[model samples]
Target: MKQWLVFPRQKVGLVCVGKPVRCSGQESCSNWRAISRTQILLHSFLLFTFLLSPIAAGAVDITQQLHRSLNSSVGRQSRDEADSLLSIGEQQYASGYADKTIASCLRALELYHSIDDLKAEGLTYNLLAKAYVQLGSLKEVEDSLRRGLAIARDTQDFQAQIFVLNNIGTFFLQQGESAAASKTVEDALAIAHGVKNIEGEGLSLSNLGLVAARLGDYNKAIKLYENALIFRRQTGDAIAEANTLNNLGDAYLASGNYQDTIATYGTAMQIAKTNRDRTNELRAIDGLVKAHSAVGRYERTFDLLEQPLTLAKELQNLREELKSFESYAQLYKQQGNYLTARNFYERAIILARTLEDSKQEVQLLDQLTKMLQLK
Candidate 1:
């Protein structure tokens, strides 16, 4: 028997034959999601067969063998393989491998959509948005979140809806849309409470705090972060816990609570070190520098700036590296060293351009022009 996959919108299709069917050509179509009644039964049988292995052997190898069995044709990998790849993507995201997370999530998304796993497909799109934001890929982030949020809304998956909404709110915050961000996170918080999802509740609370902080309501922001911290710590999610603490520190700094800012950022930095969370470590260091420098602790600020700069370079995080340079420029400007500050500003602008971060580049250029005028 032969399996000829005919995609109606295109001039070409793929061919597969025999047991453990191998596809003959590349495929990039969504029609595979239209499963017939018989095909569903066949897929269930294939999925069941893949789950059996009494080998008492290596964990991942068994999973690999199962993937081989179920991948009978193009766009037809089993849910298990897609799940495994998605798990890897999640780990890459937590460990700050933004580029790798994008690649893995893209692969998992394709497999999930082919299998009609709309929930996982939606989740993957949100995951890709998170990765894109880290790399400053603004357009990609917008597109991914748009797709993910639509899927979640259409499916009425409360958990997926909360995830997508929270992410969309965070994206809005980045774009300086404080009102939109607030409303979006409020929607997520309502869903989280209605669904009794603690993790989602925590995330929504944290995002709302970000909105409040951006709007200069430090008191409200801190209160939201504190509540979010309670839930996040209860769940033992170090990544999220550190994120909330970092944001809390920013609120403290903005409100002139320097002592609290130092303490909050110190704890975040400690957690980041223990978890090898390079991204959060950089952020924590940035907060710590601001707090110390605001209090005229230049001695500590110098070493603080150097550490994140080195770490950012090592991680190939162009955005953070440029930020480090910008921070150096700000510090020198504060000390009335215009020439040194101008040099650091130029360096940051070059890195920002390399990152294709027009927003950051333009901001840096403006600051540079203003600083030059001061002398």
Candidate 2:
């Protein structure tokens, strides 16, 4: 369960299970666009390589054989080839090709198992689970994660176990089974503490906080996030620290402590900026905008959203771009600037359709239709 911030140029998004499903606004759109652009860039680069290469087939084969021998283990190129395939799959997944990702992960897992690499096996299961999760396969989530857990336990790898536990807990959390999620993650935290793994401790703490937050235990959530923040700071894990801050800010917001929310997000913003984490910075910007808007601080909202919007557009990230459009709609809606809201809403709708996100397309259409009806 990655606490994702919405921002332009952010590289990672941890969408929590069962969180309100917002339309993948401008930010998400920009992310998709960037992915598309990267693919095009890579294809062009490969095309150039193909054009430049000599057609000495025998010589190329001999060179390839030598290179393969240098890279292969025991004359078995299976592992290396599998790894390359896995890399390709990951690149495809990142570029928004889910089916290709699943295929690639499966091939990699098969190779890893053939080579008897427990670590790679576990990781492949985790990745496969992620792809299944996106495809809305709950059974796959349980099955894949359980398989990963078994591997972790077999190896007695506490770190891997921690990841499995957190992943499982997140799955349960998404399923709305709060108690089970809590129990599972709490046990993982206990193990992390036993092993004195500070990074795992921080992550476990965040999971616990998320569970508590879902349970309406804001105080407990705050405590967990605060503890996680300490561990994150100690490890100099700015990304984790920023995520913890965002979670803490969410808790504060839920409790109607707007000032504290502002403070928490402000800290996250500073940390993200310092780390040059574009994703977290974008999320921080979103938090900042929401916080300011809640307090009727239009000037602050305007100032904060400007850079996020610019970055989203520059990166061609569809998600961020859509978010920017939605944020603008929200902002104007709040201010009773209906005409401006309508304009932004229209732009968001177009972007959503362009990205082929049916969910977002529907949501935008519904909102726009309602606005039109009001007019």
Report the number of the highest-TM-score candidate.
2
Model 1 agreement with the true structure over 1-375: per-residue lDDT tens digits: 000000111111111112111111222112111110111000000000001111111123223422333445644546767878877876676544668889998898778767776666765776686666555555565567656655655666677667666665655554545666677679879998998888778878887887787688999999999999998887777867877788788889999999999999999999978987665677788889989999999999999999988987786656567777988999999999999999999999998677555666788899999999999
The local distance difference test score of model 1 is 0.66
Model 2: per-residue Cα lDDT at residue 254 = 86
TM-scores vs. true structure, each candidate: 0.70, 0.75
- Which pairs in model 1 have colliding backbones? none
> Could you say which candidate leads in lDDT?
1
User: Candidate 1 at 336: error in angstroms?
Assistant: 1.7
Q: Can you write out model 2's per-residue Cα lDDT over 1-375, one digit (the tens) per residue?
A: 443111111112223223111212444334223322111000000000000001111112212321233334743677676667666654554343446768988887777666666666676676677555444444554457666766667667788777677776665565556676687778878998999988778878987898898789999999999999888788777877887788898889889899999999899889878877666677777877888888889998999989888977766566567778988987887777889999999998888777555666677778877776776
How many clashes in candidate 1?
0
Please give the CA lDDT of all the candidate structures: 0.66, 0.65
Model 2 TM-score on a 0 to 1 scale: 0.75
Q: By summed lDDT, which 10 consecutive residues of candidate 2 come out lowest?
A: 43-52
